[model samples]
Target: IGASAILAENAAILSSGGGDTIDLGFDLNLESPINPATVTDVSEDAIEGLKVVLAASEEAAAAAEASMPQELVDHLDELSVVALKNATNLITTSDDEVDIPPKPEVVPTIATITAPQQEQQSPQTLNADEVSLAPVAFDVDLSESSVKEKTLDEQTPSVRKILKFAIPAIGVWLCGPILSLIDTSAVGVLSGTVQQAALNPAVAVTDYAALLIAFLYTGTTNMVASAQQTDRGTKDMPRTAKMMIGAMRMSTYVGAGLGAFLFVFARPLLRGIIGNDAIGPAVFAAALKYVRIRALGMPAAAVLGSTQAACLGMQDIKSPLYVLGAAAIINFLGDMLFVGHSNPLIGGTAGAAWATVISQYAALAFFIRWLSDKATKTTNEDQPGVINLSDAILEMTSKSDKKDCNGKNRRQSFRNVMDTFKGKALDAKRKRSTLFQNKGVVQNIRESSFGKAIRRRKETTTKSSTDDDDSFSTRGFLKNRFTTRDLFKLPDAETREKFAPYVLPVTSTQVGRVSGYVAMAHVVASSLGTVSMAAQQVIVSIFYCLCPIADSLSLTAQSFVPAIAEKESSMEKSAAMKKMLVNFLKAGAIFGGAMMAAVCGIPMITGFFTPDQAVKELVNSVVPLLLVFFGVHGFVCGTEGMLLGQKDLGFLGKMYAAFFAAVPYIMLGVKRKALAGCKSAGLSSVWTVFIGYQLARCGLWLGRAAKLQRGTYIAAKEQESAAASATTNMSALLAP
Candidate 1:
């Protein structure tokens, strides 16, 4: 459990790369402070570099520990331990190694220190002159090879790369809107306003369900991305495939159950939501039928969502685009074939719902095919064999070297890994210390502790008693760690615990957002009369059409931020995240600006949706608020993306919960205005409040991103932890 906690704690650092304060487990304010300012043997760069790395990244202290020089890292690592013991009382292990608490889960600024005692006295400050800490964490390697020699361009994600992922992801986000637009245009062009208004409530119900299921896929994406980071370029493909398969199964079951519920309660849900007064009995009847049909697609939507998330986690954006594109084609064609001008037993809207369901099922089939094929691929082609994830876990917690039934893994060489995950240092002088013992391979600090541990398993070789080297190297390691388990099994508790931090916070956010959308459609806009609702639908469709433009940055942040968490240095990780954010924001800004201009300059854009002049005028009236929505929408998404990328889920969840709770009350005002028939109480006013919430959201998330980039949160958390450790007078190592 401690080992798992270490992985979870560092995963964020490995991914976010920046933490504010890194408690080096040292207390500088002991009875007599030893002068750290002047050291005889170590160069100033060595000590300064240590300082830079340890001020550490966390709670809004946007920072990551940079991979550094081996001699210095080793020297300081020993000093850190020495400093640790001299400062605070600690227990010695049987072998005399100090137990370093899993590196303080470096959360960036403003995080509450879960220190058992809040009143614990804070650590006394060390003067900079006394400490000689370096100002810069970057370029601290002090190796003869200077910064100018290393090409940072290769490290940064290029515009082409960002667009490659962002474009497809934007398409993925735009898929629903695009599909709905096809239905709206077809139904409105043929069936008229009454039929078109029916789409308002029905689409709301379906979209909310789709939004609510975000936890399934979003959690999978972050989990897979974290695993990829843990592998640190070892390319553990099987682990990834196994996780995706499990997530897909979970999503499928959840989706199916949600679909069944909706199918069973479709009528009551619609009637209860919009009530009878909103659109007349005809519109309510059509909406109920549409929702029932749409409910059938939830199971399919679930599978596709997870598949898309897995692919995106791997940074394979185009695949999701292709699947969504195919779905769109089916949806467009199905709408034409199934929906018509004249009403049959069920209405035209119901026919469109059926088309949507068919498209969803088609996407599901493609997703299933993709998953099976993806699962079978080799993780490392160069390596002759693969190691399962379960094998990886066993080695981390294993303390004994036991032989399997076949008598493989009896070799003494594979030893360091057993103690490493427990925060034990690699024995540099051991006869077969595979970690950093290759004659001149002194780059110890270049790889994360976890990264080094993972590599030990990757290059493992097993030997048997009878034949010196005949035993299978990879197979031996697997057996030594634990018995082979079914590869298709779900991720165990430890793995899910890692994912919970990333998923739980966002779960509330999604639910609140879903509630807000549902309220907007039913409680807020429903009673505004048929022409008003029809015009609202027209505006809504345009909003969906331009969604790709607004959503591009958010998707880019989601795809790339966590993908590059394994960079050698905290500086590089921080720079990389910032670079991606800057580039993505620029793209979002440019596209969003273009969208606003197009809408304002081209009012005739409404002509495509309807022949009725009344609907066009109403749509035009809301153009001002729509512009604000588009202009601010992109930035909101981009900021949220950045925060989401940082896994600042707790913050986002609160904001979203507040917004969700506010939706009903705020919409009540809109409902009253609509009842009183205020001229401004139409779509424009309703959307104005939404735009305000989005703008507020954008400001808040951006502030968070700034704090994360600065790593203030990280520094504060460490200070709090250090203080608590000192105050509590805890005997055990500081809890991670």
Candidate 2:
């Protein structure tokens, strides 16, 4: 929606008339042979010709009209007077200015009509005819439509789209495991002792900032998905994409500011988190030492993640998948090459942080490339004009760059005038010697085969042609090269209206929810026994890694369901929703079951890592319980993403709000009840918090789904009845 709105705004600017203005000299030199009657016919024929041509050649027609001889133009003005008189005579009106001749023509161009220029009022004010017809503004009734009409689709799901979306989502999820494996295998092999030491600190920093990144990145998904879900036609998609790029830039700035602030005040912050004990000091010192290294990645990570989210939102996950996949590989290699050993770029914990920083930048490049590919595919718009980060910063911030008045009235008018009389003069020149209009593959083939063929034939015949013809041809080539389709790459007006309300709120809300959840998670974790907090942290991280898949499903749901609903295809919407629900349920069930298996089965895998009995027991007991809750959470995670995608943030916000309120109580309950022995209580508290929160969230979402289902059913029934009526009407028409 955010992206779409921006595109819509761009389209509005285009609609406001962005192309260059062309001024045609309408010579008032009336020749003595000009008979008013004959002139009228010629002028009328020209006007009618222009109207007909305008159906296809708005620019050329406008140009032609603008350059008409004054004699003919005056004749045309008389025609307007005659038509106005005829209209007044036919229909009775109470107006006083009934039979006056209309205003004189102010032909701006004789070229094709572009989008109508903002008509200029004559400088003389309060002409009776003009005054009577002046527009008046009024307020629309604000009362809600009492008789609720079913939305176009009424909330159906599209399994095909969902599947298309899910495949990439799954692809994105695969990155996590790939990264973990790289960390476990390559990093370990490359520098075992250094890598092991790096692990705890790396985990700690990541954990601390994980929520921040998630919230930041969520902005991308909401904006991108909103852009996709709302049908803004093709032009708006890329414009919204550009706007999102701007927003991402804003987010990066903010993130960088925060990171810098954190780096500067790291000692104080660390002291607060860990206190004055020797372990606290060591942890704080280690964190402070490496924090800046890790923090450098914040802008890149946030921006890259947001870009990927946009890709997902646009229902183009392949780009992000490929980019991230490549990045993960690079990150793995970078970890091995730069973070350990005696190469001396970085060593120990600092080396690990440096590896993360390197990986982030590598990943960022991938995302930028993906965005570029999307832009190229979607529009004929130029590659981002300037790539210097500083230039982007200035462009985004500069007030002068914000408004585009030059592109609107001046340029469009200029184009219109040039295409008028001059257009016919150039018609033979403009006509392609070839038959087919160049588009994509056709254009490619034309370039490769047809161009060569045309050149060869031209060369064979050119023994009779002159250098003047070559120069004219060169001019034509230059004109065509510079003149891409005047389609203007403007977004649709309706698209902005459709998405403006839906997208930004959802994105902002998601950011709030994720950030809140992070803070809430920590708050709850902090109150639990320290061991439980540790257990909780690990479980949450694992959950986050797995959650993306389910979230992918939910995102698919959010995008697909409401879109179907918008079609007013109730039954289809219902079917789509049911399929999504079932898929998500199955996904949740699998995730839950798998988590349980992992948690319960961890002991079997732990022998390779360590032999500490306490660590083994704590991990094994927590894993199974954590997995079940994780599965439950997985279901809702996607559902939440879907809701956000749907731009249904009010419902989503309310649901998460309730869960947040309930989680701490659940934690307190486990803590107070002393459910587990002191040695293992921490792990149990973490387990209880997740299970309780997820279970509650699941119930809330289930209830919301049921209500939406009922609404969809009613809408579907109405649509079916309407469709049947339409069929009957069609039959009656046929009988007549």
What are the RMSD figures for all models against the true structure? 19.7, 19.6
Candidate 1 TM-score, true structure as reference: 0.60
Overall lDDT per candidate, in order of appearance? 0.60, 0.49
* Tens-digit lDDT track of model 1 for 167-279: 66777778788888888887877677777778877887777767767877767777666555554423234465556656666676668878998899887777656755635
TM-score of predicted structure 2: 0.54
How do the residues 651-689 of candidate 2 rate in per-residue lDDT, one tens digit apiece? Answer: 865655555555545555555545343544455555556
Task: Identify the candidate with maximal lDDT.
Answer: 1
Best by TM-score: 1
* Regions more than 4 Å wrong, model 1: 1-160, 186-196, 340-347, 371-499, 502-504, 523-527, 564-569, 677-680, 712-736
